[model samples]
Target: MTHGTSQSTSQSPAPTAPGAGAPSGRRPRRNKVPEVTLYFWIIKVLCTTVGETAADLLNEKAGLGLTGVSLLMSALLAVVLVVQFRTGAYRAGVYWTAVALISVVGTLISDNLTDNMGVPLETSTTVFAVVLAVVFTVWYRRERTLSIHHIDTTGREAFYWLAVLFTFALGTAAGDLVSERMDLGYWLSAVLFALAIAAVALAHRTLGLDAVGSFWIAYILTRPLGASIGDYLSQPTGDGGVGLGTVVTSALFLTVILGLVVYLAVTRKDVAPAQEAVRHAD
Candidate 1:
């Protein structure tokens, strides 16, 4: 079964609003993220895992302290986001690059709290949860809707990225708290997160959970699931990992993400033009 946003059954071309474009009569705006396909989920999980492993590699092996690593990654994220924002339409390479960078930066935010400031994971988790709620509340207050399918305006896009950043940070803290405090180990923690995501999907399918709610729930769960997988692959065997080493794991995932992003950029397979049209019609 597919996860994240449920697929739209309607196959008709999306509607377009009058005067929705520049005086040149261009088409209306569209969603930035890929369509909710198996490929989308695969790449999302891969990017999250890369974020975890890459952060660990930089902080530990590259001799960058948490603060240093965070600053560097944050800078990179900013640059990528600028490129993403400047593009007139969805470009997979620019979009996914921003996502991968944000993933690493998000993990670093939590690491700074727990490792550098000695804040408890519980506290970080709570703070991030509150922050995420505030973002959503404010976003909905201004935008009138929280549907990812309607992500066309600059305001909506801003809120969407902010919410995404908080989800990563919250997921990092929650996942770490569960794994370390409960001693569930990386593999088991991954299994638990996967199971939880599955339950969310079941609720969406069987219990009539709203599409936005189900999407956000799954999006949040992906962080921990990705982090757990990263830890399981990168840590030493004695520590319950496969001993792949952080460098290798990070490299492998990054390479795959890059390849996929390139393919999507060329093919435009994930562009959500149909959804954008539907929103305009509404």
Candidate 2:
């Protein structure tokens, strides 16, 4: 039930206000998500896969429909997010639960476009990619950086969540387009995404891609990887899946996530400092 490693102790140097001299030797603000470790990525992909199966379970198997499922999950996501934002620091349970809910909600958004409205997966993918790009552009322009290592303020948290939402939506669209339209089966698609994430990691380790870029690239890829795994597990065997069913798959992953969250909460493993300095120093 280990969620991830505890918060990092390395402090970032403080930045100065526009046109002002920088602060001297102040600590950098800690990021929201834990440091990009093997454990972090493992749980992220798990939550996303669960998100896909969970959404399908409620919408199709459970007869909630797209709109009904979206509404219910969105309401629950909002409640969890409220609790997450209100807390003074990170609690793994509240944070990861919100993430899982948003994952489902994001999948439903793309599903609504394709299933309910007949929009093509390619079109949805393009639209979401553009939206995500725009969000990153704006966030970078205003904040002057996009590093996950410094997310102490409420505004940064908002931006982080928004970007995450788009990642899930984009991943769902791209994955479906590849699997259904492009005729790449779930297993191959998952392999492709896993490779892409591996490439990002290699780039970070060998080519010195900034930590922020590496993190986001891997984060975006995890969604599709998770969705493919979810489909492979939950869909019927006739359709090439193991036929475990969405209910079982979702419940299993949720239990694992909950166990990890509870352990982290008790240990305070994911908690970071309340007010640290900015780290965009040269």
lDDT of each: 0.81, 0.76
- C-alpha RMSD of candidate 1: 4.6
The sequence of per-residue lDDT tens digits that candidate 1 reaches over residues 1-282 is 354354532321223454433112233355656677677888999999999999988988767678988998899899888787666666678888888899999999999999999999989999999999999998866655666665656666788899999999999999998988889999999999999988998998889776677888889999999999999999999999999999999999888888887887776666666644654576
Runs off by more than 4 Å, candidate 2: 1-31, 271-282
Which 10 residues in a row give candidate 1 its minimum summed lDDT?
Answer: 19-28
* Deviation (Å) of 199 in candidate 2: 1.0
* Residue 162 local lDDT, model 1: 96
Error of 1 at 120 (Å): 0.7
What would the TM-score be for candidate 1 when compared with the true structure? 0.88
Segments in model 1 whose C-alpha atoms lie over 4 Å from true places: 1-28, 273-282
Scored against the true structure, residue 199 in model 1 reaches a CA lDDT of 94
By lDDT, the best candidate is 1
Query: In candidate 2, what are the lDDT values of residues 1-282, reduced to their tens digit?
Result: 121112112323224363332222222344455544455677799899998998888887667778988999999999988887676555567778888999999999999999999999889999999999999997776565666655555676778889999999998998888787667777888998899888887876777666666777778889999999988898899988899999898988888887777776675544443322222221
